[model samples]
Target: MSVNTFNHRWASVILEALTRHGVRHICIAPGSRSTPLTLAAAANAKFICHTHFDERGLGHLALGLAKGSGERVAVIVTSGTAAANLYPAVIESGLTGERLIMLTADRPQEMIDCGANQAITQPGLFASHVTQSLNLPRPTPAIEARWLVSAVDNAVALQLQGTVHINCPFAEPLYGEWDNEEQAWSEALGDWWQESQPWLQQPQSRFSESQRDWNQWSQKRGVVVCGRLSAAEGQQVAQWAAILGWPLIADAQSQTGQPLAYADLWLGNPKAQAILQRSELVIQFGSHLTSKRLLQWQNACRPQEYWLIEDRPGRLDPAQHRGRRIATAVGEWLRQHPALPGKPWAQLLTELSSAAHTCIEQRLANEFGEAQVASRMSALLPPHGQLFLGNSLVVRLVDAFAQLPIGYPVFANRGASGIDGLISTAAGVERATCKPTLILLGDLSALYDLNSLALLRQSSAPVVILVVNNNGGQIFSLLPTPIAERERFYCMPQQVDFSHAAAMFGLHYRQPQDWASLYQQVTQAWQHGGVTLVELKVAETAGAEALRQLVQQVGAL
Candidate 1:
């Protein structure tokens, strides 16, 4: 019996289809059942394979690869508990519109739910989280090769929206290979086999909305808002705003994070809020914004025209406005609708922004602390480097105080916003793009993804992980909780030093004392040619307390 050939051929066809559609990276987790997929991927010259022992980290690794490479990346894992571990990254991919393909290996059909060690129900496993799902039977010659190709093509087409889950059940003898002549192919497939293209090419619609009222909308008092855009796109949006004489208020996740002079803090100022509220039209590009004040302003102000430009379909409007959600690429939308001549409608808004920035700079000028570090974050990174922002207090701190370096692409997992797997995701990004990476995370987040530090040693790019050790969750201080109960319940302080962790992982470690030395070391680490861990220790209550007073003073303005 040529069962091994059948299984191998099926796996080859599936992988070939994915590559034809421009997927080049495959993340693999070790398991016996997933042998067909692992072997097939390793044998293929087209795929850049990444292997991880932990499936959970592997899922996030694929997510980060998709984010960094801007292509559909696949993951291979065995069935049972391994398949369930992929749920976190799958859910994140769904929310953020990342393209991920999960190929899980399951036990054959007869291994029923009654009694099986590593077998579980495979159908509809990811539920609605993935855009498409496909379950394949064990190697069968009854189904022609063309049918398999078409099925894979059909399923992968939906990857543009989000994730695609393909479950393959392998009947064992999972080892030895066989001859190619056993499987039959059609004349059409013979032509397809020679070409490096998808068997079925589907046409895509150019755009969702027409360019009918672009001129009218462009002439109004418009404002540009950004949420999680690529660096190049954000810069173009910045240019578009400048050409139209509108102010650009970008979120923390935006590739080129022009912080709108710390919009999160300054928006509390009545004078600043009033000027922004006067905006007649608001055009928000992308989704998953980080600024609560800006989102609140959009909801409360209720501008005459609010247009959201995104490629994906669904309700991206958190403001719940009767706004037009234009389903199109930002570049295409900008191309179709050219802006009018540069006209300075409100120059005072720029002055207000500058004033707010000056007030923040003067306040945090004293010592080398978390707030100071975050405030000067834009200047902290070395030129031509990449960034990954962590969740919890650090991201909020950056959003509130720092303006990210212009033209440097920033990546984050804001969809789920959980602190877990952050280091793994960042390590994946570092591997995908061989550029110097600067990573910022709070103590708790660093601890949560501590296991992922092992992934860091493999990256060829220079990495600087700036762990702001606040000893606990500083975000709790912002909430209205009693001081007594908040200590252990809410804050959860873990006073473990990360230098020991860095040493255990064989990474270079440093503890920068002051801002001048901190900035010097961080920027220098980019040229250091290896992974360096830089820890900036501060009191647990420092960040939350400083921010409160800073905003209070800004509000008084």
Candidate 2:
């Protein structure tokens, strides 16, 4: 392949590398500068290209893909303000530590400052949020392929670690004849003449001396708090936990199964504070957690030794580690650590889990009316299906009423814990896995991503959205700072009917007003074909009191 030929095949090379590296989806937002990249991506059959008119939706869509597939996904857009539209998703992905790749098409140096329409300095634009940022060189047979391979490989490493940004800058004449494209790239390479950096094998990182102490400390009353784990990694961690007798406390985003299914002592739930107060060591992995109570508890206790593991160098502990980042596999650390001589932690945790299970069952069967709505819905969900829980009261209810289902991979946006992109992300998951995706969302979250209904038309998977409609953001009522005068600001309730919305999207809709109706509706939704929405209405005041009681029971454990 000659230098001229490189320009002709640059996108092909990049596409090939991405596909080979396991990029399953490419989300593209329409723009002029990005036409070449979009066209090339669309031409490739291996990659699934999803088009979104809105750049923000595109970013969220990519995020959803990554979340569903547990693989890195890329979002492509043109330069300038178009690229800026991705900031919200980028920030969310960064906070959640989601693996999203941002490919921005930019004007080269000359056109960048010449007052071009869509030109801007895209380099280092999202460097703060993303794991890596790169500016690609002029396409050349010799260098173009090399850069693509390098960019993707580095991007994957970062993506596996979290979110990343890569800027693809091209010279003038963004699009023209294929021959012209080749000729322009050839000339640019000739002008360069200098050699490019050769790629090298990434060095294998191992646990450091401090890491040895960290591992030892982690074994002493250490609780494994995982935000998200890939399917394979999740199983490995589970086995390691069994061997080490460690308690695995996971949030829905963890993509891993909690060790004890009905364990109320899991981290991030209301009970986690009581469990953590007795802990001497804490091993933090993945991104920031959601529960403000858990965050405050960790801050208050400031556990004796906190160890956080990350592939990339940075703050591992949300409590600001005070210790250095350990660049070793968590499994590796668990493998090296000596097994505990006694089973005090295991025995206590098992008792708590048993008691928690008993409490949940008693509450559901014998407790006050209205509490059964949440409990029944929680129980009706498939034990092994992917659960996309919405933020706010819905998530807390799942935490309160439901036991963590074994072998079920759960997910939520605990980083920011906002409800803006739930449906979009859920749509992405539906498209990616084609699995029966059950989204436990609140009315507000359902309303926020109503546009996601448009995207749902494109999904192949049958999604069952269980919208807990308490008329508004019921989570606000549970907060200590009640908005007496400012209730409207926090509890913005809308009287939007989901049945009408579902009809607009050509989806199945059902409004279950009672426990039996809700159960039957959920059974049909989960088993039926196409997308389905099952809405449940609960009283906010009664629901909050029940939740408070549930937390009290958790503390009792």
Query: Which structure among the candidates has the greatest TM-score?
Result: 1
Off by over 4 Å in 1: 177-188, 256-259
- Pairs in clash, predicted candidate 1: none
For model 2 the TM-score comes to: 0.81
Top lDDT hit: 1
RMSD of each: 1.8, 5.2
For model 2, the superposed segments whose C-alpha errors exceed 4 Å read 1-17, 107-121, 136-160, 169-177, 180-226, 231-280, 284-287, 310-312, 321-325, 338-341, 345-353, 362-378, 553-557
Give the Å error, residue 347, model 2. 4.2
How many angstroms is residue 147 displaced in model 1 relative to the true structure, after the best TM-score fit? 1.1
